[model samples]
Target: MIQAFYLPNVAQIKKRYENNVQTLLKYPFLFRKDFPDFDSLSVQYFPFDDNGYIPFYKNENRFGSYINVNDPVIDRYFFKNLDKPILASDVYSQYQLEYLNDNVRKSEWVGQENHIYLHYTNWCNFCNFLSCLNFKQLLPDKKIVFLFEEEISRYPIDFKKEFGIDYSQYQVKPIGIREVNRLIWHTQLAAHNGGDFFNEIFYDHPNLLVFKSVMFKNIKEIVKNLRRQWKQRGKLSSRLETELARLRHPTDKDFLVALFLNNACACCDNFRFKNSKLQPYSEQYSERKKRKKRSTQKRNDGISR
Candidate 1:
């Protein structure tokens, strides 16, 4: 069971540092949840202050992956594979903070938006919402990614012409949503190694934490799906439940969900590791993939016939 400390409290501070940021000089990301014994696994999250506290993302690189700032996030368990901290002076485009500073200005310029807020509760929502919007709204200044989802592409040209909100303003660009999510996972893992891994990867793009609810729902759904698969395979449902008790103390909600959702565990989404409960998910995924291929082949055969 993954119990995440979404904010930097005295407890979490105790886990990560022997001294404060002033002494350690480690710029704190949103909240270092994973800090496993002298810098190991820390929870997933976006670095808001580089050293302050802003918790509650609501899932992705599981300080539990969360929103920019609202509620606590889901638990992320990644490790550092680096020799230094992620926020060294060398990497940023030009220690100028031009891009990020611009967004803060835009927030001030555009002011507090009456923007319709859409956030994720699970990883599948991240997948589903991104599928619907095509990732145009992942940017820091986006005002209407969720709004774009409502528009269907019947005749996009005509539709754009009909709407006064210039097609250019609402362009739905393509992006590798899956790839980005993986980066979220890796960066969170790197925090334990002192955050230097970030310098290794994000020289051009500074990692902006993504909407958390999406990742949460995505993982929750995956576990649930896995459990369902196991039941279908005619395995004893109680077997996974037994495993859950062994892995996680009942006090933990994350583990409880693991136990409950274990019955339906399918595949790990953004986070790679899977609890024992959903081990059967792989077998089910393979079987389903084969069935899909076979069905497609039959359709081709019919066209030939």
Candidate 2:
């Protein structure tokens, strides 16, 4: 049984780290009441640190160890002295198993084999651009499914109105982190802009198709080429290949840090190289300024006429 402990002041905690609860919500199966082992497993709510770490406790015997979810130093110390620290990514996989077991009998839309799961959360501009590349004309034979981070109604514009493609015609579903974990199991191929969620879920998946922007006119062709190269060489020729390699054999906590730095820009910056080495952000800033100046000059000249 696994027990997670958090501060009792829920509103205050949620306001501080908005995504914290969202992350924890993925483990609902641990608290299920109907399971035969439910009595053995339980979660307790307590008035603990309101501004500090969320704690986790596991009790197999009379004694249990305390783990601070937010403390990296503690996590490292534990790993070095005791056992490999249970990472958020580790829990992510566990959540998937629990979800699959619970829903195995149900007729929910679990992905199919060789299916392409596009992680379009609608939160990142780059992800949105990648999703747009999955035009119907590109992959007529493949089964393409889109996983959204939020409900369709929350989106400001419909895909039909904005991109001229009716998303309803395709399999588009809003999913939480747990559902995403379950979906990844059935997905043989995936296309994403290197979001953290995707990075964690598909870290071990061998056939991942990562793209930065809409550089090619045909998304399907590009994915096919990448998959071919990946199968032959065990890696892609893209800039993200190095980062992707590190993800495959993630050894320590640095993997998550690397993913964060690598995925810093959802669409714009090629973080694969930038995050690995020292570079000047000012250079990119200056280039943007120059482009803005040129655009402004053209606009001013047009207005003067």
Candidate 3:
């Protein structure tokens, strides 16, 4: 879960902030979820004086990675409360505001009659949606749709072309048919970290049959598929679930590697790691040549003797 506190409150912020100028300072991208100890991280706003909070500058490292604000009120708040306070200004990028305004608030589409929105806030989620799309999950009477975040253009993938949207057109908008009650949108908010959509978009949906493509959710599906395949092949281990549960602080990569290994094992009757012979063919060949040369030299020396 992500906890964010903005002075003037996010709802009260002006429209310009909603526009999310690339150079402008926005809310921080909290990795607090990444750290269990800092699960309830908050970005409270406190100013040094009544002149309103001084505008902060960009970190230049990456969009919304971190911010450096010099305010006495904020400093004091951090000093007394948490050792390292992540101020609202510190973790903001244009993406944060974009998510808030374009996706969450401008969601008038959510209120439409007989509609189910299949929203993909980033490229990874979009790809996941495409791969795991099951028409049976959607209501036949209701329209099915897709949503994409505009920043998806940054990825090399031709998403617009995929859905028959104009390739040149770029913006956060819905793009899907409405034969009954379905819609699609490109609400590009969370970029590299697609998981953040679970926190940002999932909680507040009202009367809206909203579904965001989540990587972990897809992983669960992949696990089930692999489990069935392995079980069918008589390779399902009783201890497999236990082994997965034993992983401490496992990442998406870890789960993926496990899935891949299980699938490979099921596909191949003789799947085993030969670490000793895992080297590249070129390297192994060179080693063999070196050994042959050494043997030849020893034989030549013996002949001379």
Candidate 4:
């Protein structure tokens, strides 16, 4: 059975996201209808953060943003720990089970719902994808459907090539947030890579299985490592604040550190830090275009010769 867990403490979270949270809280009251109970579980790359801070947040560009890591040593540290493959059993452990059990007991989902929805963003990594496989294994009898952001349709990863998962098995629809809410009622279990919609969904639906991926245990130490590095850097730049502002909500002294590490390790973007600032993707794209043009010109010259 999928399990529900405690929602993150957003008491001090920013107003930008808090508005959605408030709206979600009023959902059941407004509808005043009997919502079916399903075993709901939310999953992400890392285990869910119990302390209330979500690792992923929206950027000004509305893309998966990464924290700038000026130190090569620290950058390499995150890549080694986060970019590796993870096993299902390693994550679905006693600790997670306990949280799920406790939450499920308090939830309204009385455990009869059978539909499972797997939601992820365009920037999800192999580990996030691995969780979907784990869920299918855990609940084979349920009707499972994968719902991804429309942008995922353009993602270049080959599921079959990398993990032996047939594209046909995905059964995904490129959808938006509205579509997700429309289908949420039918979803007995909901798992998503921590997305912005989490603000509206996490506590709004009780008794359903919903989980937000936080960070993994193996990489927690990076939080300390990055804190020291950033502390030494003195003041944070405006660009970095795009992420740091949201992370500051958690009371942990360097709570933002763990979140920074989370964004730095995202699988989708090849993020780089320059002069202690995060590089924009537009620049990266322009560079790629120039390189392609240069390569094409070289090939034509060689042919003429």
- The per-residue C-alpha lDDT of model 4 at residue 252 equals 35
Clashes of each: 53, 0, 24, 9
What is every candidate's alpha-carbon RMSD to the true fold? 23.6, 23.2, 25.6, 22.7
List the candidates' TM-scores in order.
0.21, 0.21, 0.16, 0.21
Q: How does candidate 4 score on lDDT?
A: 0.31
Q: What is the lDDT of residue 228 in candidate 2?
A: 44
For the record, the alpha-carbon RMSD of candidate 4 to the native fold, in angstroms, is 22.7
Worst 10 residues of 1 by lDDT: 83-92
Regions of model 1 farther than 4 Å from truth: 1-239, 247-256, 263-288, 299-305
Kindly give the stretch of ten consecutive residues in candidate 2 with the minimal lDDT sum: 77-86
Off by over 4 Å in 4: 1-225, 231-237, 245-284, 292-305
The stretch of ten residues in a row with the least summed lDDT in candidate 4 is 174-183
Summarize candidate 1's per-residue lDDT along 10-76 as a digit string, tens digits.
3544433333222212331111222223222232222354333332223343233223222223232
